[model samples]
Target: MNVYMKEQEIKTKLSAWVAGQSSGYHADSVPFDLRIIEQRIITSVQIMELILFLEHLRGEPINPMQIKPGAFSTINSIYQHFFIEGQAYA
Candidate 1:
């Protein structure tokens, strides 16, 4: 079967994950600013948690060397790195 995952779906999942972080803001409350970096809201612990979450979600180990500051900068940045770049499965 051909499964198509929409960008909004991906964004929703990512937004939900971000909400689980210590950002102190609801997922829906945050503006959909793709340019917002993780450093602005996410804590170090949250970033680690996000890494584990992404690894599990992608069903593969994310190489540490491949991770960049820009990778986890924003929801859209993460989406682009994992989904658009074909590094992760839906």
Candidate 2:
């Protein structure tokens, strides 16, 4: 695997995570229009779970600053934070 995941890969993994976290969603697929804020998937209980998921995916400690208001707004947003701007492990 590449040290850093491409945009689409990150999005796919994030979608999978979202699906796993939600009861009615499918783990293998996500809708193109899905948005975290609109879907309200990020409940207070999910914050730590999300952090741990990102850390595991990136193989590094995720910074607290990256967990901002719009960080988990969408799969694309999470990709940008973890892989693009934040720079996943190595």
Candidate 3:
């Protein structure tokens, strides 16, 4: 896994993407624990866009079989499941 990207950098990019998904948010102000999907901060269709963003960030394709809805529930969970070592419970 060439997941050598710094965690902060990854989170920054992720935050920017999520913030851009909404009109009233900013990258730095995006709450890590916010239930974006559940709150409709990001639309259902945007979920696929999020996945694609993550894939581009991680430089790899996420295994569809290993994905769970909980992994996409929030910014923090998404980072934990995809970028962090060992925390990727998939």
Candidate 4:
């Protein structure tokens, strides 16, 4: 698939997974609206969790090193990292 289509697909899957994780924590903590927390507070642990979850959903092995600073900074970044850089399941 083309990059745009691939990014969209990844976004959809990531949204679902994030929603699930959010619900697991609190009913009101929607993953998409994490704006309540300052961006500076977003730790590597959280990013790593997201990376592992996405990798699991794609039936691929998780690679923490692939999730670099610019890569896991945002949802879009995650998509770019895995699809464009890591090229997992591409």
- When sorted by lDDT, best at the front, the candidate numbers are 3, 2, 1, 4
State which candidate has the highest TM-score. 3
What local distance difference test score does each model get? 0.68, 0.72, 0.77, 0.58
How do the residues 1-90 of candidate 1 rate in per-residue lDDT, one tens digit apiece? 223457776677778777766457677654446444534577666777877787777777777567755777788788778767746333
C-alpha lDDT of residue 29 in model 3? 77
Which residue pairs in model 4 clash with each other?
none
Candidate 1 least-lDDT 10 residues = 30-39
Q: Which ten residues in a row have the lowest lDDT in candidate 3?
A: 81-90
Q: Give the per-residue Cα lDDT of candidate 3 at 5.
A: 55
Question: In candidate 3, what are the lDDT values of residues 54-86, reduced to their tens digit?
Answer: 888777777656776588788888888887642
Over 4 Å off, model 4: 1-3, 23-46, 87-90
Query: How far in Å is the alpha carbon of 26 misplaced in model 2?
Result: 0.7
Runs off by more than 4 Å, candidate 1: 1-5, 34-39, 86-90
Evaluated at residue 16, the lDDT of candidate 1 is: 78
TM-score of each: 0.72, 0.75, 0.80, 0.57
